[model samples]
Target: MYVVVLIVVVVVVVVVVVVVVVVVVVVVIVVHVVAAAVVVVVVVVVGVVVVVVVVVVVVVVVVVVVVVVVVVVLVVVVVVSAAAVVVLVVLVVVVVVVVVVVVVVVVLVVVVVVAAAAVSSPCDHASSSSSSSSSSSSSSSSSSFSSSSTSSSSFFLSFSFFFFFSSSLISPPFSSSSYQSVLIVVVVVVVVVVVVVVVVVVVVIVVVVVEVVVVVVVVVVAVVVLVVASVIVASVIVAAVVVVVVAVVVVVVVVVVVVVVVVVIVVLVVVVAVVVVVLVNFEAFNANYKIYALAF
Candidate 1:
């Protein structure tokens, strides 16, 4: 009976031990599987987050670069265009001033030469008359010579006075019969040249201005359109519209100002040229008239 009891106890103990070992092995296997699954899930989640962050960073970088490039290009183009306009305007002004100076110099030189010639001619006539008077021995011949000289001198003086008055009234002091035609021709040529130069300068300025304005407007509009297309925001679109309107207004104001300035310059140039011509002619006439009066 004791051996039977002992064997039964050993079998029970062994069975209990075997069952506990089996349970422990199963628990270990379950724990290992759960740990592996958790690790795989963590790895997958981390990869997805990393991919999303990289994509977002790349997109932001691309957008920023594109915007910077567009802005830089626009600014460069505008600067170049403005510089060209300024250079052209400066060159035109310099040319106009040079031409005017040259014309005035030529006119002054001509007046001096003509006045000198007129003064010398009167002196020669007086010397000749004095010589004729001196050579005469007979009183009768002397009387006749004196009378002829008096009549000739009187007629010449009257003619000169009439010419001077008429020239002042009709042609601003260039009505001497000998030189009237030449002086008129010179005046006409100078006026025509000035007009032609002014017209050419104005035309070039207008064309260049128009081209620049068109290019600027187009660029601005294109930029606005691109911005509006890229962004679907109402505030952005409104701002773009406002910018375009302002740009247009500014362009219009610039064009108007430029036109007014050009017109003023042309008018001033014409006035100065006329004044110079008048002054030169008047001085020449006064000098010639005084010389003739003294000679007679």
Candidate 2:
């Protein structure tokens, strides 16, 4: 019974150990598989994010550079055109002033010629004829000067107006610093994205390493437990066998002692019975001999 119980205990322990080991192995495998899947997912996500970030950065950089270039070119064109307009305006103002001055000077000359003509008398025919002829020539010259000055003044005013209108229409309002700030912001964003990617990669690597180590430890522990359990089961079986062997030896010794005692008692009883028979036969012979003598 004890041996049977011992065997049952050992079997139970072995079964439990086997079950525990199997469970541990299965758990470890599942954990490893899950960890691997997580790592793969994280890696894929990070890769995709990195790719997207890189593509976005490239596009942003290209766009920023192109925008900066375009803005610079546009600014230069606008500044140059503005400067040209200013120069043209100055020139036009100067021309208009000059035309006004020439017109004033011509008006003063015409007034002087008219005054001279009015002051001279028509008393001397030869002198009157010569004075009339000088007045007529002066009037023609003054008229010609006045017409030319008016035309030049009008032309300059029209040119200045056109330039002012053109300048207003062509120049952009935004500053160069605005464009610089935009570029700076784009660069900072790119840097931030790169940093984030690096951080994510580091985190993923750490997590994977931790998961692998944990799985290894679990597997090692399970194996060690199985080994320890096997050793214990073997020891128990050995102890049970030893107890059964001791019990069997004790039972055999008791049987041998009982058989020896029974044989000794039977031999003593037979020896006593023989001694009694011999004594009774001797007494009977003696009594017969006495009877024979008396009869003689």
lDDT of 1 by residue, 201-294 (tens): 5654564456455545644554444434433343244345534554554456445545644554455446445645655656587679768867
TM for every model, in the order presented, reads 0.44, 0.24
Task: List where candidate 2 sits over 4 angstroms from the true fold.
Answer: 1-54, 122-296
lDDT value for model 1: 0.49
lDDT of 2 at 162: 51
Candidate 2: worst 10 consecutive residues by lDDT?
A: 167-176
Q: Candidate 1 vs. truth: CA RMSD?
A: 39.4
Clashes of 2: 0
lDDT tens per residue, model 2, 1-296: 22123223323332333233233333433444443333333333333344456575654454354345434433543454344335434433443444344335434533443333332322234344544555556566787765665565555555554543443233211123422432343333333323332332333233333434443343333333322432334334433443344344334433433343343234323433443343344345435645774699
lDDT of 1 at 40: 30
> Candidate 2 — what's its lDDT?
0.38
Clash pairs for candidate 2: none
**Model 1 lDDT, residue 249, Cα:** 44
Clashes per model (N, Cα, C within 3 A): 0, 0
